[model samples]
Target: MKYHVVTLGCQMNMSDSERVISVLEEAGYQWTDNEEEAGVIGILACSVRQKAIDKVYSRIHKWNKWKNNKNLVTFISGCILPDDHEKFLKLFDITFQMKDLPELPKMISSYGITTPTHLNVGIDPHNENIEDFWNVQPHYQSNFEAFIPIQNGCDKFCTYCAVPYTRGREVSRPSKDIIAEVALLVAQGYKSITLLGQNVNSYGLDKKGEELTFPQLLREIGELGKRMKKEFWLYFTSPHPRDMTDEVIEVIAEYPVLGKQIHLPMQSGDDKVLMRMNRKHNMEKYRHIVETIRRIIPQATLFTDVIVGFTGETEEQFENTRKAFDEFKFNMSYTAIYSPRPGATSHRWVDDVPLEEKKRRLHQLTEDLRKHNLPYNESLVGQTVRILVRGEDRKEGFLTSYTEGKLTIRFACTDKSMIGQFADVKITSASDFSLEGELVEVAASC
Candidate 1:
């Protein structure tokens, strides 16, 4: 039997899908990209936004329709809130938490689909750490890039977020396991590795004395990188501004393995809006973190996430967000239009910002980003930088690559063999978000 897993949402979802693929394939299901060809379908979904949830309903509706003509089973997991959970349980053939991944085979065994793992599963409740799930090696989808989930769940209950409800409280993984995984990936020649979490900086706080702190974990990884004699870029995502410390920035600056790109989310620029969102830190605190990053890692390309409109956001309040674009001069910003979802604190409050006004703010911030980003890319013109050649670009005769700072680059190349290798490229032209370059040199395997 063949299976297909549809993934939606963040890099963390993509990472989770990799592990899901391993479980399905181990249970004797061949992996397939074509949903029509598969007897089993699974979705590693995201519930952060309404649009992602809409896609989930559309896909499952279509997948369920397939059951009338053929034998099929479907499953769902990842970032599902309590409200959706009650409904999804009735919709999917098997609905289970990520921590219960080891029981997947046993769950599907009722349909006569069986595996060795299923035989071992006898209905004991899973451990809180999801250790069995962690033990399952991910069937990495990329030759040069990979995602390593260092931690699971969220502790910070931001008013607008459903992560605390969906993922539960924060739980840090055993540092030994994480180090072992990273060491193995590097030994296998994987280059681009990202550490994923809802709030990455808060890692190890739950485990305090048991596991290494986020900075300590990075220091170990940095030391490992030095000893491995490998060329790779390490990154982490979506850390809360509250947990962000100067020590973390110092650690990053000290480590060459740590990527020069940082994704710090400033959800709103206005202090009142941030307060309403339950983001503990104010504008003054967030600005300090940004300033620290600038002073410590001057060459780093800064990225952020911001919400355009939240409940009770006034016109003047939105203007502060607009002004933040100018103050920060962010190389990139993921501007989101806020939508109230069930199980979140914000959902209790009236969604005061009009949809059209949210769009206007989002557009305004995007234009500001272009203005800021163009100059950074333009400055790279004529400079030779090493990039991890990803794959062929959509444009004919061009290939895609990324700098250590994770800037996108496209350059003309006929040798597709260099796709997974590191190469030097001289920037010839620049666009708002990406760079066009000329191939200069090819280096070691990524």
Candidate 2:
């Protein structure tokens, strides 16, 4: 039997897919990159964005058509809102929460498809089942880079976000499991490891008395790096500004393995707009966080997420956002125009921002980002920075990689074997978002 997984959305979804692959492979199914060749098809769906949801519907429509002529079992999981899940139950052969992943083999077998009889059959009705889902060893897809999920779901209930509705309240994985995973990956020579969560800095607060805080977790991983004598970069993503503490910043600065990059999301810049989005943090607090980062980790690269033309956003409000952009001078920003999705708090409100105005705002922020990013990229010109070679670039004869600061750079290299290794590159030219460089030399592996 062969299985194919179509992953959509963030790295957290990708991590979920890795575990899904593991479960399928354990049930004697081989993975196929081509959907047409697979007997079992699954989609790790994303409900956060309407565009992503549209892609999921399009894919399932085609997959259902194929089912008329072939024997195939289709399933869907990952970041699915309650409404989407209810709808998916009718469309997909099977639809389950991510916590129910261990029972998937049995679910497939129940369809009259033969599976290993010795497979685990019982499903725990309690939270223990959720723990099992996290315990399932993922068949990691990347040799050089990996994502370890430290926490799952969200509690912030940001009005514009579907995460709280889809994934439920936050659940932090045991710090021991996280440390063990990182230690093993580091020992196996993974060059880059990212700790993934919707709001990473909020980790352990839900289990405050039992689990390690986010800063404490970093300290443990930092100790492991020192003890292992390995050279690798550890990173985390999408932390809420409200939870980003000075302790976390200090821990990051103390650790050499932790990369000097932060992705704090500023969903909207205007105070009223932020309040409407339920971000729980003001512009003043956000500014303070950035100032702290600069003061502590002076060489750190800053990245952020911003939503433009949010509901009821005025022209003056957007101008405030633009002013915020100018004030922060972010190296990069994942800017998106607001789009209401069913099941989110914001969905009930009228989407007052016009589409054309949304597009205009998006473009304006993008230009602001580029204007700020170019100077930082330009500053790297003539400097040699260490990069983990990702793969070949779209431009022929060049290879693609990212610096420790997560800056994308393409360089001329014939040695394809260097793709998974670290190398130093001399920046020759700079663009708004990326850099052009030449390989200085591959770094010696630890």
Candidate 3:
């Protein structure tokens, strides 16, 4: 059988899709890029946004119409809500939770020969068997960059997020397991790796009272840069404001292999909103943390996640968020118009803001963020930044690479093999989203 998988939501979904692909391949199924040409279609979905869910509905409708006479089977799973499950069942041929996925080969085989009589109940597998998921070498889509999920799920249970419900509580993989995986990737010539998690900061909290903590995990991984004799870049994503410990910051500051960019999430700038969301940290506390990070690592670039137009957010509250952004001078910010999520504690509260107002606030916040980022990008001009060349630019033969601080750079280079190597590029110009540069020199081979 042939399959095509569509994934939505966070990197966790992307990681899960990769696991699905590995399992499918092991089960003797081929893959096709075209969904229309596949014998089976798998959708790894996200329930966080209403729009994302609607898109899944639209795809199911389109595929249901096409599958009436066709022999295709459609599967829906991953971060689905109970309400969405009912809707999915009406259209999809099979709907199951992601945790129950290891037994998919049997289900598929029985269905392929003759439909099984018994219902397939969802079962939580032993996540400690990290090898089951991380063992198979992934068919990575990118040659130079890869998303490595070091952890999964969020324990914070922010009032407005569905991650806690859909992905379950915090779970950290064994530190040795993670380092071994990274070492293998480094050996494979992968140039960059971004550790992924819902809240990467809480990585070792699950293993509390154990010897292998988060800082220890980072120290172990940092040592790999010396042990493997490689200079490839390392990074992690979406750290919660509350979990930025001094040790993590110090490790990043010390390890040259670790990227200089930090993507810390500050969901709201108002202390009241944060309190309501159960963020556990106030604006003052967050500012102190950021200040400490800058104090320790002056060159570190910072990115943030902000949500505007939350329920009951007043003009003054919104202004507080803008002021915070201005004060921090974040290199980049992801601002979103707040929308109520199902199965969240905040859903009962009225979503009172008008759509136009929500959009306006989001725009104003993004514009304010640009005031900081534009200057930072402009400052890069004339400075040589180390970048890992990833691929060819779509518009031209110019090569594209991502810098140590996670900025994308477009520069002209004659050597196509440089696509998987780190090279120094002198920044010539910059824009809101990208940097234009000229290749300076490629680093010595490891």
Please provide, for model 1 over 178-200, each residue's C-alpha lDDT reduced to its tens digit, 9 standing for 90 to 100. 99999999999998999988888
Model 1 poorest 10 in a row by lDDT: 117-126
lDDT tens readout by residue for model 3, 203-247: 888878773766677777788897888888888887887888888
Model 3 spans with C-alpha error above 4 angstroms: 86-91, 112-119, 123-131, 394-397, 442-446
Candidate 2 clashes between residue pairs 3 or more apart in a chain or in different chains:
none
Flag regions of model 2 displaced more than 4 Å.
Answer: 112-128, 442-446
User: Judged by lDDT, which candidate is best?
Assistant: 2
lDDT value for candidate 2?
0.88
Two-way lDDT contest, 1 vs 2, winner: 2
* Pairs with backbone N, CA or C atoms under 3 Å apart (clashes), candidate 3: none
Score every model by TM-score: 0.93, 0.93, 0.92
Superposed model 1: Cα runs more than 4 Å off: 112-129, 442-446
Reference-based lDDT, each prediction: 0.85, 0.88, 0.79
Ranking by TM-score: 2, 1, 3
Each prediction's number of clashing residue pairs:
0, 0, 0
